[model samples]
Target: MKKIIFIFLLALSFGCSESDSASNDSTGQGGSLAVFALKDNYLYSVDHMKLNVFSLINGEKPVKVNDIPIGFDIETLFAYGDNLFIGSRNGMFIYSISNPENPTKLSSVQHFTACDPVIANSTHSFVTLNSNTTCGNNTNVLQVYDTKDLKNPKLIHSRNLMQPKGIGFYTAKYLLVCDDVLKIFNIENPSEPILVHAIDKNCFDVIIRDNTLFAIGDKGVYRYKMNPNDIKDIQLESETNF
Candidate 1:
């Protein structure tokens, strides 16, 4: 019932013009486990092997626009500007949504088999590979790729992590990754992220909006107030246990 309500709210939220919506909100920039993302008047979703595009121009009724075959084991979707970042067991696929009704494949970055979740901006893309999952091997790490050349993403740096899941930017300089705990990193230099802080709560995913963060874990959903001035001054706001 709660899930239904959440989806319904998202539907209404995306009904408005793109200029009226906050692009960094949970409905726009989702967690790594997100299968669907809202961009402008369209919603892009993925199944195991396909990318589905839906037009929300009518607001009340969503019209399926296109269904393009992506690779298998497609697990997550993230949208930045006019591009869509897809995470699969095998690689990260970048697609151009400049044509909302007809998205075109741009390029792909192949990686080892793993449970992958990805996020990106114009400068760089971040991917977390969890080895504990069925899709992963023995490699568990966070990789940073220089996306200056979107067609050929070059891996610039990598750091070993526990079982990292969803990732998001708290600020342009701060990044949040979920693992054994809520780990925060200073991405002042996009290529070399330095670990800054870690919250004790075990989280699986996180949704960041401005200074507010919503973290999801096995036990429940937790919210925190992020201080933009102080990287280590995150304060718990609320929690909803399952």
Candidate 2:
């Protein structure tokens, strides 16, 4: 029942996504939509279905280096090793970021209607098929690819799940999936991911703080007991932010 409600809420909010810069117009998630890499300050995320690259530190204006067209329902942005990757409704899109001012679109691969926003790693990208796709109804599968060669990626593995929901990767080995329960899988072997653990309630996006894991749930953002070793030990610590 809780899972159903989340799906409905997320689906209902899709139509609100729009294009046009925030300064030029007034639309989108009210300029709150954002994604950024704590490691790289050169790239920043924008709500209007594109990414902004800083030409210079503290520049007067950020440039829309990548033109993905906001109306396409893009939700996530990740930049790693001179490349940028985005998660859209259709699939995952890869771009070359040799020049911060101009990001080149390398490819757009189709999958399911992905959402709630995540990128596994700059080298390994993952997306949750939140809902069904035209190809077939979603059975909750996480697509894991060998992006070592960005230009021509190889489909390394697919972890089929039930309502993959949102995802977060700690060391490119463990994939924490959000759903009615928190599902953790050890992808030490991407081709054959092994189940690590599962717990009840909501788990959306997850992050790391010191040795703890921060998870985003329907209620709010909270801390979790994340063991680099054991998944069964994971337990909620305290609520932080949503």
Candidate 3:
């Protein structure tokens, strides 16, 4: 159980890949739920080599629609506007979901074998690679890319991290990274992100809604009240053990 917690912590803190249509922005609202992503009336799931598509038209029950074969060791899933990002140990894959039932591959950026999860808004995407027992011989760093062109994502810059896990966008201006510690950065300038504040706490993943921040780690579920005026003024509202 301890081993599972450690692994979960590592995977949760980095970032998760996502996909969604522009019409439905609420599907990928939280960063912590990485395994599954929703777009319109469909839900996509990844398990090793297969991308499973399910229709939520019935809402209560998921109807299996299609099973698309993908690369090995798929780690996370994220839904951006009209696009789905798949994070495999080998690289990042982007898919167009104009037809949610049948997603087509647009492009992919290959990287060294590592544990990676990605998150993005409309313009930029963030991917973090972490070195772990499962991820062999990989350097830990945060890679940022310009997603202006869906077919061709350009790598703009990268920032080295100790061990990055789940990442959250507080706004277009601020980003939260969970690793050995919780670090928030001022990304007003996406190309040059500056670390504004950090907490000496081990964190796995985080999600921000309105003015509240939710995070989970070995300690348990954590909740905080966020102050946009001062990123450093985050107040711990409550905590519960798992």
Choose the strongest candidate by TM-score: 1
Model 3 TM-score, all chains together: 0.88
Query: Which stretches of model 3 miss by more than 4 angstroms?
Result: 1-24
Evaluate model 1: give its TM-score.
Answer: 0.90
Which parts of model 1 are misplaced by more than 4 Å? 1-27
In terms of lDDT, model 2 sits at 0.56
Clashes of 3: 18
- Tens digit per residue, CA lDDT, model 3, 77-157: 877778888888888889888899999999999998888889877888888888978888767988888888878999988
lDDT of 2 by residue, 106-223 (tens): 7667765555344544456666666535324544666777776677766777766666666655555677777657787787777667777876767655544334665556666666
Worst 10 residues of 1 by lDDT: 17-26
Residue 121 lDDT in candidate 3: 76
Backbone-clash count (model 2): 1
Q: Which stretches of candidate 2 lie over 4 Å from their true place?
A: 1-41, 59-71, 113-118, 132-139, 240-242
Rank order (by TM-score, best first): 1, 3, 2
